[model samples]
Target: MNTAVSQQPDAGVLLELDGIGISFGGLRAVDDLSFKIRRGEIVGLIGPNGAGKTTVFNMITGVYRPTDGRIRWHGRDITGLAPHRIAEAGIRRTFQTIRLFQDMTVLENVIAGQHLKMRQSWWQGLLNTPAQRREERELVEHAMEVLQKLDLADVAHEIATSLPYGAQRRVEMARTLVAKPELIILDEPAAGLNEQESAGLNDTIRAIRDAGITVILVEHDMSVVMNVTDNIVVINFGKKIAEGKPAEIRSNPLVIEAYLGQDDEEEDDPLLNAVHDQVNA
Candidate 1:
């Protein structure tokens, strides 16, 4: 699956997952899934538990190689590039759970995200060469600008993990943003946020898109996805069941069936009613 690509996605397309599938031992985790993201779009990949959302993330980010298909970045196949190489290729992601440096200040944690861009040799570091010092200073300067951009500059000196839960999540995002990814993948970015916090997240996501970053998210919080994403892709048992606009997916019979079983009587069904009310809210 290792490929060398040298071309562009036709027109505005940024990334394409063409018939991608992956397996764990003999069990298929994702099957024949395909999607394309145009530049500056926010798309959501969602499904019920164990529906293979994260597996698709792993494959796209090069943590796993799709046994069945190729992943293209700007029309260049990047199916089996090493994870670091993929990061170097302007793709980065944040985990479902916040992962931050407990011992480092928020600014340090974000600054560390630039590890991939560090170019000084080890010897240069040992001697504290002028070029190395200049590079380090530049990284700090760039990280500070990102912190300000993300509204975290005031807490930049605080320990990353000591911040409130929502702020910690923003720190993780700041780290990812400091990497300057053209395509950012978010896994449940609003998992534990309260209503107010989640609403703020909608704005953050849009700002990222407006800043010319394409986003793909796997989120269990339907409200966040429905409100934040430009398009939604739904999957069940590793297969796509529906892909469409929020209003369309909110009422799709296939989506309702996937969330609630097919045996529902379709009358005054509280669970079904709740799902409809919740997502549409």
Candidate 2:
């Protein structure tokens, strides 16, 4: 059941997962999942609860190693690299639940994310060498620039957890951006956002892609997934079920069945109804 991407990745391809799978105990959490992300494209990975969406993100970011298959980035094999090495390789991610340094100021949190990119060694930092001092100054400047872009500059000095929920989410994104990632994996970013905030987040995602960073997101919000992503990959029980454009996915029987179930009465479910409205609108 190898579902790996068939052809060799072209120059535009930024990531490729070939027949990747992982298990816990005797249960296979993710089985033979594969997908490709092109440079500068926003790809949405969507599925029902327990579909192993976040598990895929875990594998890609090195939080967990796949028991089978390969992960390639820029045509280089990085299947089981350490998390720090993965980040160093230009991949960064956000969690479904915001993982921010609650006690740290918005600016400081972003600066923390830039630690890997900093050239200062432990000794240099301990001694506060001239180069270390210079790097610190540059890091602050870069963090501020990222905050400004995310519209969080005004709250740069505010504590991370003290901000409003939407602002807090933006802070997390700002932190990830400070890492200068080539591919950003956002796990359920729209989860707790209001309609207005979700819309704004959608715009922010597009802006990130426009800036030449590739994005792969796992989200349950159909509207955001439909509006923001250039392509959609659907999974069910850990295996890929459907992959296509928004319009195609909206009308896909497999996706519709997976989300809304096959029951005739469930066909009018709110999520499916909204999908229909969006497709028509």
Candidate 3:
């Protein structure tokens, strides 16, 4: 099932996934999905469990090459690039499960993100050369700047495992930003947050856009999507069912039926009801 969107002039497209299809054994996980992510836009990808949301993320970040497709970053073929190479090409991402160095302090976690940016060679870091020392000091300063920006400086010295769940999520986001990627893909960023915490995340996401980076997020919280996303793409049975603004997605019968069929009455998530009620309110 190929899905297509015509190119637009004003909102320049930053990422393009064309004819992307991936399968595991005999089952098709993602089928011929195509979409354009505009520069500085917040695009949400939503679907139920087993909808191939995370599989698409893996393909984009080089965790897996698509069975069939071409991925373009800034309009250049980037398919099958090594994960580190993709990171170097201005793309960074966070996982659904927080992947942080638990024993490492928050500051160290952020500093680790800059490993790619450090100019010093392995021998320099190993031998502690003056140039390496200076670069490490500079990386710390840059990491602190990121911590301050994310309001994580208060816990900068604490062990990452000591922070609350929401704070842990923030730290992961700070690490992603530390890489200074032009495009960021967030997988289920609001997964464990409460209502108020999710709302705060909405503000933080908007701040990222204001800072001139594009965000592609996969979230189950309809509230966050309605409140933050500039555009949305809905997938079910590993195929795109709808693509539009929050308002349009909510009103689309096919989208409603897709989720409603699985579990009616908002599917045991207040996030969905929050979106619907807010829309009616």
Candidate 4:
């Protein structure tokens, strides 16, 4: 990881992955990978398919604990915290697949994302106390505000899973944003959208950043990655190969070779085979 340039001592780093790695059985899925994310910046984590991008996301979000290295949240050692605990600690993430509530209205679905921050206890909800009602009203107001920001307010009362695919993606993002996380990890948010929808996504992501939330975006769309990110961290076979501004990453010989090289199938086969054997072992 050539990251000396990326790790500034004075940069307001919100998250740090120090030599983080994970393995499956005996197969190393991710090696010693590291990067620093400054607060309020959109950082792109990109590589070819099967580059362990989502594995890194899983480790950061506590779906998978790292076999090596430390993960720090705002200078606190948060390695191996349970997923709910991590979410409570002001970190949230979206999945590659949209996970909206099937039957809930869009506003209701987004309001649910704030459960970790809900002040009313279960007993209060059970009792339908005045305080609980007040809290509910406040949360509903905030969720609608977030939906307006995501351009989904018009559909706030629509069934969430019934919206168009692009709108569903925005709903998932609206759900994440409603939580007010300090850092949001988006896993391929633009995966199924057309060009216009992708363009809308770019604006939405920038709005999130401008609101002072640091973002770690794992995306395959080059236009989105190149147009939106403040910095890019490139990986292949689970190792950090490049980290810099998008323009710099765009021209780097190593990154170009990794993405455009003719022999990638052969190059990636060894690690692919190792993971396959591990899964079947």
Which structure is stronger by TM-score: 1 or 2? 1
Residues 191-272, model 3: lDDT tens digits: 8998888888998898888778899999878778888999999888788899999889878888776665676644666545
Compose the digit string of candidate 1's lDDT tens values, residues 117-140.
Answer: 889988999999999999989999
lDDT of 4 by residue, 45-78 (tens): 9876778999999999999999899888777778
lDDT on C-alpha atoms for all candidate structures:
0.86, 0.87, 0.85, 0.86
Clash list (residue pairs), candidate 2: none
Q: Candidate 3 at residue 140, lDDT?
A: 90
Judging by lDDT against the true structure, name the best candidate. Answer: 2
Q: Tell me the lDDT of model 2 at 200.
A: 94
Candidate 4 deviant stretches above 4 angstroms? 1-11, 262-281
Error of 3 at 106 (Å): 0.8
Model 3 alpha-carbon drift over 4 Å, by segment: 1-11, 263-266, 269-281
lDDT of 2 by residue, 1-281 (tens): 23233455677999998899999999888899888899889999988767899999999989999999899888778888889889999999999899898699999999998888888899999999999999999999999998988899999999999998989999999899999999999988987899999999998898888777899988867888888999999888899999999889988888877876645775665555665565467
The parts of candidate 1 lying over 4 Å away from their true place are: 5-8, 262-274, 279-281
- Which 10 successive residues of model 4 have the least lDDT summed? 1-10
